[model samples]
Target: MTTVEPPSWQSLRAAEARLINTGVPGVSVGNAVFESIVTGLRESLLRLAAPQQAQALGVPPVVSRGLLERVGYIDGFPNLVGTVYSFTGSGADWNRLQEARAATDAAWYQEQQISEVALLPATCHHIYPLFEGVDLPGPAVLTAEAHCYRHEGTHELGRLRSFRMREFVRIAAPDDCIRWRDDWMEQQRAWLTSLGLETSVEPASDPFFGSAARLMKATQREQELKFELRVPVGDGLVQAVASCNYHKEHFGEPFGIRVAGEPAHSACAAFGLERIVLALIAAHGDIPADWPQHVRSVLSLDDAGVA
Candidate 1:
């Protein structure tokens, strides 16, 4: 049997650079066609969620540092966190900063104070806190898209330092939350197949930092709390384009979100917007004009209506 190997990161990166401008190492400015695919995928997700009366929210790209700490983000993935810092210096400090800048003293920027908010690591992170101290009469569903950041050093085609995530979060009883996630897993697979991408849903775990995180990862997988929808990105690697996570009272207890006087169970379906676009490009090639009719039609590329 002949096996088709995945493309390498170098090849994908080159293709992306040709198709979209990548002035920043881990960030890129997508062309019109690129944006169209992203928008179409995002819209498709929204359409899939139409049955549920999900309250749509537009969360800020940055969230308060205090909130992040409360959610244990600092304890778990501190390495990936990005803090916003600004120049809060007086006149003398400003003068010193300018002088240091002229001399190319990188350390001079450290004089600035850290801002109250930090770049959001995920779209769902900010949603859970909003329900704090509220007793959910029933299941609450929230849909949001936000720019997220991670400080992972390596930047490849599918992996980015900063990216966009479209998330659907459900806060409800344990059974309801699990069912919602499983249903969406199947639904998401069907949608991805419609877009002509081969996908698989498998048990997964987060990249928890530090030596102790090994136990956390094993526990997560053992409990089957996380699952990912993976698509071939390149170099024999399948990247996670979306994930279904079951946080069993992890966020609820910390945030005081209760349902029926008990701590609510929360789950989220998160889609990596840029990775989906990259997968589409990898599967169909970068040229929109040469893509399959179905692909173009699904993405609404012919009419430029995706935006």
Candidate 2:
């Protein structure tokens, strides 16, 4: 067997410093990094969208509990939702909430429902439902960035309880949907190539909710249905730099994202902007001169003018 080497000292140092700086639970360099990635990602995605397609929209930071419930998220994966609740009274309740959380208090909190709201789980969840019951002249594309929240157990450096996600979504007839998914992957591959990253296209499947998740992954190789572009980040960590997903009719059915008159098909390509930035920083170090000249030049320019 080939011996595995450790992550590069330079890259590890940078990852540590950056990760520590950004990983604050509610605040940290994580926010700043997220902001920077979102800014660059939006510019890049908008460049690839159809000219007359629907303009980009910013989804609400938080999706309502009811909306998520309607979509069956609560039943499918309650563990991943950050539910909003309140203490029963005014001062006493406020004090109770402010105290450091202990492991043993699950039911006590449920007694208080000042309002039932949930932090948004996925950025695209807010945007996809906007097409419900609307008749459109033709296909539309939407690009959006949102700070998404998840209640999970992982406390890693790059992963966050809250992080920004940028997605380019298309809703239209079946043919248009398939073309959008296939074409965007090609465009994204070209773009990544220009950035000097080696990439591969591999089929992937959704992390379907419930027990079906495992079966779906095994039977249909659902994880392979969607293709991901990954770049090695030294060590053994290969960041999922970008992804082109074919949701087919899964989201369209629930959201009623119909075509001109028929039931629509929907698809989206999501770039883990922060992950991509991390990969770039790790592989190329922090110097601008190290990046491909074209990519570096684009990074130098503002949205208003090329540098």
Candidate 3:
């Protein structure tokens, strides 16, 4: 039997280079065609969510540090969080900073003050806090898109330090939440198939930090709390392009979200926008104009005039 090897990081990188500009390690600047596909996908997601009556939200890239703390994000993934900092020093301090920079001092950045906000780690992080101390009259569904950041040690194509996530969240009774998530799982699978991408759904876990996180990951998978939609990117490698997560009462209890006097169960269907674009490029090649008719139409690139 001939076994095909999965795509290596170098192969993925080369493929990405042909479709987008990577000016920084682990970060990318999408070319016009790339951005067009992303925008079209986001619009399609919004249209699909419209029937659910979800309140569309455009969340800021930065979220409050306190909010993350309340939700135990710092405790769980402190290493992955990106804290914002700014120079808040006087003229003398600025002079010292300049001198330190000129001297190539390693600790020069220590002079800056940490800001109240940090780069948003996930799109759903900001949604929970909005329902704090309030009882939802019934189920609440929200759809949002945000630029998310993480401090990943390794940089690879589709696994970026900064990316965009489109999330459809539901805060409701446990049964309702789980049902909504499962339904979306099927819907997302169908949507990916419609784009002519080979895809699979499998149980998965978050990359939690620390030794204790092993137990958390095991528990998460054991409980089937998360499942990912994986697509072949290159070689034989498969990348997770989207995820469906059932938080149960995780966010509700922490943020004081209540539905009918009890902690509400929350679930989210999240789409990694950039990863989808990369998956498309991997499957269809760098030329958007040469992609299948259905794919181009779905992405609204049929008349985009891209060469």
**TM-score for every candidate vs. truth?**
0.89, 0.77, 0.89
- Native-to-model Cα distance after best TM-score fit, residue 271 in candidate 3, in Å: 0.5
lDDT score, candidate 1, position 153: 77
Query: Which residue runs does candidate 2 get wrong by more than 4 Å?
Result: 1-38, 50-52, 88-114, 219-225, 301-307
Query: Which structure among the candidates has the greatest TM-score?
Result: 3
lDDT of 3 by residue, 1-307 (tens): 0111233233333312233334555676665556778887987788777799999887999999988888888888999999999888899988877887888864767777899989999999989988988898999999899989998887556668888999999999999999999999999999998878899999999888997799989999999999999997654568999999999889999878899887899999999998887788778876667889888787776655554
Per-residue lDDT for 219 in model 3?
97
**Compared with the true structure, what per-residue lDDT tens digits does model 2 show for residues 43-63?**
766665656365678687787
The alpha-carbon lDDT assigned to residue 65 of candidate 1 equals 92
lDDT of each: 0.81, 0.64, 0.82
- Model 1 residue runs over 4 Å out of place are 1-22, 96-107, 305-307
TM-score of 3: 0.89
Worst 10 residues of 2 by lDDT: 1-10
Off by over 4 Å in 3: 1-22, 99-108, 303-307
